[model samples]
Target: MSTGPGADSAPAPTTHDSRSTPEKTPPPGTRAKSSMFSSLKVRNYRLFFAGQVVSNIGTWMQRIAQDWLVLSLTGSATAVGVTTALQFLPMLLFGLYGGVLVDRLPKRRTLLVTQTSMAVTGVALALLTLSGHVEVWHVYVAAFAVGLATVVDNPARQSFVSEMVGPDQLQNAVSLNSANFQSARLVGPAVAGLMITGVGTGWAFLFNGLSFVAPIAGLLLMRARELHVVQRAPRGKGQLREGLQYVAGRPDLIWPIVLVGFIGTFGFNFPVYLSAFADDVFHAGAGSYSLFNTLMAVGSLVGALLAARRGTARMRVLIAAAVAFGLVELVAAAAPSLWLFALLMAPIGMFGMTVNVTANTSIQMGTDPAMRGRVMALYMMVFLGGSPVGAPIAGWITDAYGVRAGLAVGGAVSAAAAVTIGLFLARVGGLRLSVGWRHGHPTVRFVPRERREELTAAA
Candidate 1:
């Protein structure tokens, strides 16, 4: 079943006649069957993709600057946690409302407003930091503003992809989006670190502020005539509750969200941990800290590319990736030297991106199209909103137990969550995990004992 981007609306499914299937293969040398990158065929998506790449770099720069600014001011791990919490707390509080707004409005216009707001906020932060009169309060205010914008921006941005590429290219577009983000992660912090060393955090903010121009321009330049507008529903009472109900009814949706919340809340509060490790454990400077993040992004970029190559998005892969990601984090926490820890970050990032891309792709593919905005919004809440709760806990742990212990605790919790969820899914799906060969390749498959018996009988 399909649905539009609001409550109480469903779309008719397009029919495919099995009897009409063609047996003939396509001619060779005719593009050799386009891969996932085919989404770039759309002019609007190309513009949007290009703009987001530039904007994401700036966003990452601001993130680094904000973390550094908070640490410099308070000199407390908990303070950095507080800042992170403030930045993401709004998503926890108002994300559902934000989803509703996205459904009710034209996404292109909404994004324009959000991008403008964020630019203003970045400029405000830059001015404060540059004047030498900025205080912790100013940073808090700016962070809150950014978070507020995110509450609206995230859902719109996510839902907008389908409108750009259409449902046929949704998975490819999503994977590419992950690639875009991780790519920015690779560049942004490294640039911010150099900027911080040469000028100050303020300039990073200014650069980020200027980066908004690319996206704003992209949004303005989008030929609305080219958009594949999803039919939208009129707003109504209990829309938020209705969205919640739709998600609650689908295990495919709920389980991934639950898993993401567990991992995000327990495992993904890296900003706090990275800062603590940099200052307390390694006694390193900001450049080394940025280097650590850049290495992780290297891993993440590879993971994204790998995900893009996959033929299908499967639940088993998501669960396995989550488990692997947790294990990598556990190992990373125990590294004895800064160089060792930095090296360990590669797999940690790779697996983290694996989980992120898999979960995101599965949720988007599985959700009802009408409710896509709300579902993705909830996904974002779990994926990002958990930061508010997790950051402070990680911060406090870093302060109380030392950075290594704090990181170790997070890793342990993440591993435990992955194991628990994997077990639950196996039981519910009546699946037993096994490694085997398929299509002349090594593969993993989950099968019920009865299904195995039936298959053998049929053979």
Candidate 2:
């Protein structure tokens, strides 16, 4: 679940060329160049990447600052949880309608308004903090306002990728987008910690507010005539229901959404987990907290780059990543020392990101363009909107049982969901998990049911 400080789980670079391209683009299943930065070759996408890099770093800074700010004011982990809940509560309530809005409106125009609103919210918070009038209520209202803006921004940005780079680089562009966020993840937290310690949280918020300028400028500078715009959904009745019905009829779309709901609700409550661990379990200050985030960012950056290099996202990859994410989190939870736990954050971040990039890319590739915004809204809603419900539970667990148990619960649920879905998909898809020796090496593979008889006869 990408949090407010940054749109952490937003789309990364991936390319899927639509048939409407001037040239005949390859089929949806065709592989792309494995270069991690391949999508940047397009001038429009390049501008978007550059602008987003700056904006995302600022976003991360705000996220780190926002969480710390709340913790400092209240001194209760539960209160911190409440702030996270407040930030995402609007997403739970209005995210679907935002999707409907995105589909009906021009994506670029919609993004412009949403980004500007978010910038205003950031500046308002900074002013409040700097003026010494910032209270718990101000923070709450700012969080909610940001959430409300995100309801539209999230889907608009996801569907906007196609317009920038077209379908050919869809997967690569999307993966790069994640890498961009992860890259920001590395820089933002370290800088935020220093700012928080050296100056105050106000400066970080101020920096984030101004950073929105880059994206606004970039959007204005784009050559509108060159954009590979998709067909917009017309004004019509039952649009929201139609979007839901479309997904409901497709197993490929619906299952991933369901899986993300469980994982997002339980596992992606990291801000709550990390903050509590820093403040309570480790007794480490903001600096130590920043270090943990930086290390995880390192892993996430690596994972996103690797995903970009792979050039394809499959259901199998998503399942494997989810399982690994859970196992790594569990291992991290059991680490006895702060340093060991910190080191484990790398793999945990890597696998967590793998699941993230995989699921997002798959959904986009499998979906219809006209319905893209609405479908992505549902995806974002499941992945992020659940934070309102999950954060409080995680906070309560962290406050009561200790950070370890809270983390373990998230890990267990994440792993269980991945395993359950994987096995069920295998059964329905007419595949069996086969274990055997290939030459001298033992191997496990998923074999099609029709191929089992031939393999048995040969053996």
Maximum-lDDT candidate: 2
lDDT of 2 by residue, 297-378 (tens): 8899889888988877778989999999898889888888889988988888888888888888888877777688899999
Candidate 1 displacement at residue 10 in angstroms = 17
The list of candidate 2 runs beyond 4 A from truth reads 1-31, 65-83, 127-139, 196-202, 275-288, 395-402
Per model, state how many residue pairs clash.
Answer: 2, 28
For model 1, residues 1-459, the per-residue Cα lDDT tens digits are: 121243112332333221232122224223123376777888888988999899999999999899999899989877887787788888989998898888777788789899999999999889988998899989888999899999999998998887777656666677788999989987887799899999999999999999999988887777765677454535677878878988887787798899889889888888888877888889998877877888888888888777766624667788888888888888888888999999988888888888888788777666655576778889998888787678789989888888888888888887788788887888887777756678899977768968777766866
- Candidate 1 lDDT for residue 447: 81
| Residue 122 shift from truth in candidate 1, angstroms | 2.6
Top of the candidates by TM-score: 2
The reply for model 1, stretches above 4 Å from the true place, is 1-36, 67-83, 125-136, 196-202, 272-288, 334-339, 395-408, 434-444, 448-450, 455-459
lDDT, candidate 1, equals 0.80
